[model samples]
Target: MTAISRTGAGRRGVATLICGALAAGGLAAAGAAALAPGAAYASSHREAPLISGTPQYDNTDVYAFVSPDKPDSTTIIANWIPFEEPAGGPNFFQFAEDAQYDLHIDNNGDAKDDLIFRYTFNTHTKNKKTFLYNTGVVESLDDPDLNITQTYDLELIKLKNKRVEHETKLADDVPVAPSNVGKASMPYYSKLRDQAIYKLPNDAKTFAGQADDPFFLDLRVFDLLYGGDLSEVGNDTLKGYNVNSIALQVPTDLIAESKHQPIVGIWSTTQRRNAQGYYEQVSRLGNPLVNEVVNPIKDKDKFNASEPKDDAQFLKNVTNPELPKLIEAIYKIKAPAEPRNDLVDVFLKGVKGLNQPPYVTPSEELRLNTSIKPSMHPKRLGVLDGDNAGFPNGRRLTDDVIDASLQVVEGELVGSKNDLGDAVDKNDKSFEKYFPYVALPTEGSRGKTAKSSADTKSALGDGLTGATSENTPLIAASAGAGAAGILLIGGGLMWWRRMRRNY
Candidate 1:
């Protein structure tokens, strides 16, 4: 919701790179550039037009890494849809039965996944009788002995040559239980989620489940862009929140060679009933939902529809899209001095190698090469300074990726010739050490006649009391102009392009 605007030219440049090839004539290229359009940052939680309506199968984000808790193993997590209220349920969220939930790994960087873990869910509703809520006071049952029960099953499918190489049923050895509905159901949701965890053929660990959501961002700030104050919106808004989560843990050895060269790229997808009974898909490939939406690209729909398993074909589409030329045509500025074959290298190969002078890494892809082991964890990895918990490693909740992305475009971390912007700290909040990491509170509990254990826990985690305030400015003064210009230009170009396409 942050209304950062890119100028017409800047947006045109972005649009050209993303839309499609430049026309044969120089004028045509210019015409395409002029048609560049605006692109918006699709919110990982509630951005997609289709998925937002269907939370059960909508995948909000996907994360993969070697477990910090157990460095020897890898963990893959996919969050289905977003904004799930823990207590909001006559029927709580569950995975789709017809959908395929998968975890992909690319040991060989052809931009394709070498290993895959697919899962499906089945729910059995019994007794045919239904009640919305259980008030602890049980009414007379027509059939006292008849009770409702539900359960599901999971599977791990390995693929080679686009065909199933092997299929392993996780439920074969483990019992798959349905989520806990209430007392009658025993709330065994956690246990059912745990059943999905299994050991791979090589003793590698794997898991999938619905855990609380772990992403934090301020949508209110975006709403304020039309005309509102973001300064008053503290980081507390995202505190004590939760979302549905799917997690997996595996061994790095199972994913990459000991040599540790970069060997993985990840993506998540959601398929729903299309106009035809066939499924329509929505995907987040390589670094969550950024590239397909925020970063420049022409085939936004195609990007969303494609799967990570088909990366070889799509990688080429991402690297050499006709959009760039279209942007150049619109902007009237010369493109990067040299032919950017490195676009493929940086966008597809990975960012580690792209950190050189003159050239800067294009979009941030969370790259995890099994080989590089830092002696210490970085404070902030992606965009948050001192935030080592972001992309190219593993993304964390507190990472202010918008700021990080601006920094990347400006080439701040790698020191490109391009003029970069200063950093911004929109939300000056700190986090708690719990399942969902979020900022602590700044006030003390009031109007409380008596404090219970739950109150005390909430107080401690709320950060309202005994919490220090940090006055970190979200954006440096110097960065405002260039960043705004880039946003406006880029956005304008995207808008133009879309209009042209429609015609």
Candidate 2:
């Protein structure tokens, strides 16, 4: 199901909060366990019921931001196949050829997609008779030894003025970068990844391949979400993880309808032609985690399948968020109250002047203001730290969403008064400083689960400090808003903000 049209509803309301950057959603909340692998605490892993069982097409996370280095273009990256173990050989992870993965832009913002960027992958096995992914050291994406390879085609379709126009071959037969097997197999991994970057006819640049997963969070946050000792919990759980990413870098005006109002809302979704011969949205994400922690189980699947227009049913959940209440109940932390128009305006609508499109609807989509110039000293904490070009504006590769999410949801403002964080401060690897900005995928041979942090025992003194939950008083602060990292809201959506969380 694609191509729905709507006129303009309007842009977000004025700065009713501290800053106009935060949208909504985080990597995953620190609490609430789920019945499925990706269902835990509302990160974009296996966010929905049906897609949790199918990781290949489960939309993990979508990041949209104006290129920090190249501010003239907008970078949109959509990831899939999460919690990837680098060494899963024989058959390494690949995009599902049968599924259609898409990144949509709601330029006019009536909760309908005005511009759509779709990617369909084709996995080709050169020597199907072979058991190995590559018979020998894979020289290139086109190397004959590569027994199995994948390539994709990209299309930019649009619904404008009630007219549907299709651009069939924005990029065609584009070779996807191969999995980083090992140094022996992929000696020049950088070259191999760069080779896959295809410049589109629309003057956009595209790259589809395996890359390091940029998301960072303390996974144990689900279990009271503590990790003072690195050994027990502070380790980066996604250290060796990899993902199939479809990325595009295009001029702001190419996607957004207006030149003056460069604000545009974006989201990514995956769908497959089902048994009934109907295309069904299996995974949908904009801001982040709205499904995992925000919605009741009964409505989670429905939420995934439905459109942003239907978000009103779930509006109550955000207006009166249950996660903050749950956190306050268990952790005895004080959070903001309901009718959280603050959250509604930031999460559903864009923060007024920053990312909120001139004409928009209350929908779940990553909104970016192309006008916000990139920051050289980019803060991983994003808007909270006052880097307007960071996440919640439109997530950059280095944005520390976990911390930002925790601070905002806890009712803290973007100030130094309260320090709420998961302790896993950044990504496993430093992201590349250029286009296709995510770091290369972890080598298959080197992949493994994260271990405890090295500083674990030293700081906490063998669980003594870690056990001071009751002794440490929650810091108290006003609900005055602060700057935010841009993210949005949805089942798989991730909206970002900076805040104080006092105990």
Candidate 3:
């Protein structure tokens, strides 16, 4: 039987909650997990203070959905390094070589992960003598002119009760798509991205590269909640930004439980090597705004380091949320009553019958029922609009989580129907219809240079001249100034070497 048919009671149960408190005139709170791996915005991108300073290892968003073109397979995409400016180059963006990026899945109702896909990257530089991200117009992934490149290894791990039962290296030395350096460097950026998509065993596929920041929403909500008058609305704050992404697609049966039970919970985390060299989870994400909007400041850092099995310790934040109270005080809207089991049902435990697994353990993760097919024209509001294949059921790239979350958090399910939103809707760029559906990264030379091939080649040739071409003259002049000049040159060379290493 299909998931929708089997979970009829669960859907009805949710409806009952929606209808029961129609007269309350209270705010419905938005709380749930997951977003398209390509999507951006919300607190998931640098949501916590400590993680914010370390963008490379910070998880921005996570997306899991039944592949639209290949419904028999499931696709999971996770992004890191939020708000990547295409023009921000020289060193550009690359996955952290010292960190482990992981996608965790809970096939059973228990909070423990049953399967994990771990990705680790390694960076290689061809011409370190030249401080250029690329020595010339990089035509391909393996081009020597592409001064810096990255490759990753993908490992599939099966676990039982939080212990690894088996481990298999699914892929090794897979090339990562280079950053969109611009028309001069990567005029065929899409072609480069296509080359990065790797076909794996069991008809699976994987991709790691730079893509457009798919998350769309006004980030100005921090300014006194839209200037306390809803004036801050309709702006797509992350429009031109880019993000580093890792995407994978596998057969539905691969990650699903038995045919009798098909729901799976998904989340992603980044474990960075601390000073002691032991990997420690520094960032985590599942739901769109859980840590950003739900967890308080004191718990934000703690939430990143915690596991879902221990989420009960933070239950009070969800049961008695502070966002609604803040909205109530500012907008004169009535806040929902305390001890909100509705939130626990939606955010922690999967909705009964719909996506909930047998004997659920009430943990935070994006839940998806493999039995549910993809929607051709999915609604942005997701389940609220009866689109079962979208978010809260595995986030899609097009789901308008910000608006949907706004209404849900303001009491759409518990009677207080509202249309509250930040006014932003869809992404500034359209998404691709094929595998690794994220939009192409914004170009570094967007609307600036339209250089000809000769012009580009000439520029690269000029850039190839090492630091001696420019700085040697200065050092020579300083040497003529005697002892003071020697000290200055020593300090200058040390600073130059450090800068080169950083890039």
User: Best candidate per lDDT, number?
Assistant: 3
Q: For model 2, how does the per-residue alpha-carbon lDDT over 1-503 read when each residue is reduced to its tens digit?
A: 11111121221222312111121111133222111112111346765677788898877777888887778889999898988888888778999877889888877767777888889988887655446676555667787656688888888887765467666558778999988887656667788898998887657799999999887765654443332112344467778889889899998888877787788877888888888887778778776545766677777777777777666766565666566665555455555655555454455566676777656667666778887888878777676566777766777778877656565555543221334555566787888888899998888764332222222223223223223443223211111121122221332232222222221
Q: How many Å off is the CA of 383 in candidate 1?
A: 9.0
TM-score of 1: 0.57
How accurate locally is residue 193 in candidate 1, as Cα lDDT from 0 to 100? 44
Error of 3 at 444 (Å): 1.3
Maximum-TM-score candidate: 3
List per-prediction Cα lDDT, in the order shown.
0.41, 0.66, 0.76
How many pairs of residues collide in each model? 70, 37, 10
Q: What stretches of model 2 exceed 4 Å from their correct place? A: 1-43, 161-163, 224-233, 413-417, 446-503
lDDT (Cα) of model 1 = 0.41
C-alpha TM-scores of all predictions? 0.57, 0.78, 0.85
Candidate 2 Cα lDDT to native: 0.66
User: At residue 392, what lDDT does model 2 achieve?
Assistant: 68
Worst 10-residue lDDT window, candidate 2: 32-41
Model 3 lDDT per residue over 1-503, tens place = 12221121332232322322221212123432221111112346778889889999988888889999999999999999999989997889999999999999999978889999999999998776776787666777887668899999999999998889999999999999999988877777888999999999999999999999988876766666654544335568898999999999999899998788999998899999989989998888877776776677898888888887887777676666777787677666777676665455665666666787889887778889888899988877777677888777878989877666665556666776555555555899999999999999998885444354445545444435453344354445544678787889999999999999999
